[model samples]
Target: MLLTVSGPPGSGKSTAAAALATALDYEHVSGGDVFRELAEERGMSLGEFNALAEEDDTIDRDLDRRLREISETRDEVVLESRLSGWMAAEHADLRIWLDAPLDVRAERIAAREEKPVEQAREETVTRAESEALRYREYYGIEIDDLSIYDAVLNTARWGPAETTELLVALAESYDPQTDEGTFPVSGVRYEF
Candidate 1:
């Protein structure tokens, strides 16, 4: 069973994915970390890496192929990425969308990157815009769409462990044969 977790930056997608994967004895794959490592190896910034991705279809295709192959072999796998839902497609047994408020995300990113809140907020907005545009231009995908997901979760009200537990429960209760599913939100339901 492949579980694909996606969300905007600092939304706790990676944290929840790791914890859920560990609890379920699944292999965890983080696309953002992979891209960051690639960027470092190439001595380029994330913006430059994203520009390269826009120009190079091979990079995205290769990663998608590798992820699909992994899904084929692994019984339990947790795929954490902004575009994993689109890339993994049929390979993912359940697609999860994790979200948090903009202010909360900005704070998280600032703390994680050791940057000022103002700078982190600017960078987050820039990166999110670049990612959204790049993904659409390169793969014709909109990362914010939730219709493709089995469960949509908000992490602003819950920590990593609690969010992971909720995801695991949802995964266990999911019936691939049925269209019914559960979406965990803090207060309101988003149409997308």
Candidate 2:
């Protein structure tokens, strides 16, 4: 099974994906990890790298290409990234968008990075705008659209363990044989 987990910054996508992959005994691939590695290798901050990407599309393109390659060839994998849902839509068995309110997400970021909540909020918004602009200009993708996701969950409502347990259960219970069926969301299944 190929599962793609996507959401905005500090939405716990990477953590959730890793937990889900572990529960399912799947390989976990994180696009953010790759992006961060590149930034570190170049001896630059994430903000600097993101700014450079705005000028040079190659940075985003290269990372996206690597994600596509993994999705195309791999099975039993969990791919996590902001655009992973869009990139792995065709190959993914489940495309999940895990997010929370901007403030909640920002708070999580602040806690994780040990920065002030206000500072984290500003950085998150700036990074999101930068990526959104580039994604639109380069790929014609509207990142805000949730139509592609099979499941959408609010990470702020649950801790990592609970979220992982819920997702693992959902993945196991999903019936792939039912083509063009509805997905359960907050106890209500909505048909497409």
Candidate 3:
């Protein structure tokens, strides 16, 4: 049972995903962490990482390949990525999309990274735009779209624990083999 959590920058997707994975005893795989590790290994900054991803198709391909390989063996894994919803279509028992207000997201990023709010806001907007553009150009993927997901969540009102509880409820009600291609039990729709 593969589960995926996706959202825009600073939307608490990682926090919620980790909590969900822990509650369900699932392995957690994060694309953002993978990208960060890869970038560090190559001795590059975040901007450089985005730049390289834009210029190199091989990087994204390799990342996707590794994710696929992991998913094959893990019975219940929580995968978090900008493109997780799309990638997990075949394997995911449930896909969750986390959403938060821009201001809230900016605040979270600033506080978490210890940066000036204005600087964090600028960085967040830039990274978000760059990621959307590059992912589309490089892989024909639009992470902003929620149609690919089984559930859409607004994290602005809920804390990580509450969100995890909700996800667990959804997961408990989900039967992957029979529920394939079905929408979320919550029946919430995201406006593109």
Candidate 4:
């Protein structure tokens, strides 16, 4: 089964995805890894690369293209990114969108990055806005839309371990043989 785990920064997406992947014996592929690779390739900071990505559309396209390929061809894999649900499309057996309140997310991010909460909060907000705009312009995707997801989880309500258990239960209970339906993605142009 292909599982898509998507969420904003500091929302415990990476943590949950890692745990879910291990619990289910599935490989985890993250867009963040690719993004970091792109950044390192350019000899630039993440902030600088993010700014460049906003101006140069290909950066995001390249990242999405790789993840999409993995999703389209792989099974028993966990695909994770802010837009992983959409990137996985019909190939995903379970599409999950995890999120938390901005304040909670900022605090989590602060601890992980060893940064100040206020600084994390401001950067998180700015990055989200920038990525939302890029997603809209590049693929006609509205980050606010949740209709495509099978599960929408608020990570603030649970710690990473609890969230992983919940996801494992959700996946174990899913029976593709008696599947209801997979909402088809349409209208958007996938140039990647």
Candidate 5:
């Protein structure tokens, strides 16, 4: 079973995905880690790489392609990324979207990154705008759409531990035999 955890920054995607993988004894693959490595390889900061990626489609397309391949080849893995749900598409057994209000997410991001809340908030807004445009332009995906996700959780309501427990239970009780189908990938335009 391939589980894809997708959410915006500060939405507990990495924390929950790691915990879920440990509890379920599955491999955890993070697209953020991959992206960060790509940034490091280019001798750029994450923000710098994000800016570069906006101008160079290959950056995101290449990263997304690797993730898509991982999804296609792997089972019993937890894949985490903002686009993992959409990238995995039909290969994903359970696609979960985690979210929180922008303010709450901004605070979380600030605390995690050891930055001022105001700066984090501003960056959050800017990054979201950039991503929304890129997602729409590059893949024909509406970043706001939750229709493709099997479950959408508000990570702000519970702490990371509780969120992981919730996902654990969801994975444990999952019975594909009696399950309704997930939404199909539609209206996507893959550049590669």
Candidate 6:
């Protein structure tokens, strides 16, 4: 099964995806990790790299293309990225979108990065806006649109354990062989 987990920065997507992968014994690929690695290689901070991305689309396209290739060629892998769900929408068996309030996400970022909450909040907002604009300009994808996701979870309301458990259960029950276009499980909806 190919599962794509996507959310805004600090939405706990990587945590949830990693947990789900461990529980299911599946390989996990994280686009953010890859992006971060690239930034580190160039000795640039994430915000600086993001600004560079505005002037040059190659960086985003390169990472996104790699993600698409992985999603199309791999199975039993959880693909994690902001646009992973959208890029892999046609190939992914399950697409999940995790959501949390901006303030909650900002707090998480602050804690993770060991920065002040206000600074983290500002950086997060700037990065999000930059990504949204670039995504639209380059791929005609609106990052705000979550209609492509098969399942939507509010990370703020549901803790990591609860969210991971729900995803694991969903994965355990999915059957592709006897399936229609919709999810195999009943009561599942593509929600924003």
* lDDT values for all models: 0.80, 0.88, 0.81, 0.87, 0.88, 0.90
lDDT, candidate 2, 48-165, per-residue tens: 9999999999999999999999999998999999999888878887888899999999888999999999999999999999999999998899999888887888988889998898
Runs of candidate 3 exceeding 4 Å displacement: 180-192
Clashing pairs in 3: none
**TM-scores for all predictions:** 0.85, 0.92, 0.89, 0.92, 0.91, 0.95
Per TM-score, the best of the predicted structures is: 6
lDDT of 1 at 80: 86
Which digits, one per residue and each the tens of the lDDT, describe model 3 over residues 38-90? 99999998778877887887888788777777766677899998778776677
For residue 61, give model 3's deviation from the true position in Å. Answer: 2.3
Global local distance difference test of model 5: 0.88
- Residue-pair clash count for candidate 3: 0
**Candidate 2 — which residues are off by over 4 angstroms?**
175-192
In the range 8-79, model 6's lDDT, one tens digit per residue, is: 998999999999999999999999999999999999999999999999999999999999999889999999
What's the true lDDT of residue 18 in model 4? 90
Which one is best on lDDT? 6
* lDDT for residue 26 in candidate 3, whole number 0-100: 86
Instruction: Please write out the lDDT profile of model 1 over residues 37-93, one tens digit for every residue.
Output: 888999998778777877787777666677667666776789988888877886787
Residue pairs in candidate 1 whose N, alpha carbon or C atoms collide under 3 angstroms:
1-75
Quote model 5's TM-score. Answer: 0.91
TM-score of 2: 0.92
RMSD vs true structure, all candidates: 3.6, 2.8, 2.7, 5.8, 5.8, 2.0
Error of 5 at 181 (Å): 10
